[model samples]
Target: MSRKIAWIAAGGLAATLTACPARTPSLPNTPAPIHVPPGCEKNQTGEYHHAENPAFLYFGEDDGGTLTLGVARAREGLEGPGDAGTTVNIVLQRTPDGFVGETRSTTFTPSGTACPVRFPTEATACDDKGLTLRSVAATSIDENCRPAPTGPNPQWKEQRLVRGAPDAGASDAG
Candidate 1:
């Protein structure tokens, strides 16, 4: 019957569509393994200082070689974020079971807010300057160039206070 033939054709098309290979092609739902930039030394324990700006943005392996990322702003130049300071920490612990990425943002002043937004990521985080920190590769290059190879995020005005090549120190070592 023509009805039977139509059903057979529909079934074949459905099977072919499900087997298509273009489902998803992207990085895993989490950040890649942390890679410490060259020329920077990891502290005996805790995060390594990758860049400095009165405060420090630290990233590297800790005492047990556990990869971690953190930012610290403190009074009296305290060494660790737990001191009289606050911090934002992102730790990636790999295990046989799975990968665990724990991120915590410390607020200097309690806003007494009743919460509005639910989910927030690094890209949504803003600093005291009200500017978001852009992502730079381990080599300090703007690999993705979200803003531009030489441009910063929120690309409205030119406001890169520290201007230089990412690997300026490595190149100047000679």
Candidate 2:
């Protein structure tokens, strides 16, 4: 009968629709691994020094400051179960002269493409008198230029402030 035919057609259409697989949304461009120059190695440590402001030194707790740099092992291509690569996060107070006070957190990734590690220079602070503080020197760790990871997690290695401005010299040497 017409009813039977209609039911059969509806069932066939429903079955066909269910048989098709769902499509997944395309993912955005993932960044490649950051490059690590010679002397820079995995788990290596260092400090982000202020050229002029000695108080604004980025080092570990043992270095007389609170801010400490941390790193984690990341799989190639930045794929991993936890924090990928060497992540560098800084926990310091923002000051008119530069980052002062306690260093809240910092991570450094020693591989892959360049990523922004932190706000190295500040116009108001470092650019004072037209002279930039400039990240004079850093320890021999792979400092990747990428955004720091977030969340209430723990797996980062604490970095100590080995040296700072007036002593730590100047250069982007991690």
Please name the candidate that would achieve the greatest TM-score relative to the true structure. 1
Give each model's clash number. Answer: 0, 35
Best by lDDT: 2
TM-score of each: 0.27, 0.22
Whole-model Cα lDDT of every candidate shown, in order: 0.36, 0.37
- The sequence of per-residue lDDT tens digits that candidate 1 reaches over residues 18-131 is 888775667658755543322112332333332344334344344543435554433343455433344456554343322234445432213332221111222222122222
Q: Candidate 2 residues 1-174, lDDT tens each? A: 999999999999999999999889989988554332222222222444433333334433323222334323222344563343335444433333344332122444556454343434211122111212223133222344433354333232222233333343333322
Candidate 2's displacement at residue 23, Å, is 4.1
Segments of candidate 1 deviating more than 4 angstroms: 1-47, 50-54, 57-65, 74-85, 95-102, 107-111, 114-174
lDDT of 2: 0.37
Candidate 1 global TM-score: 0.27
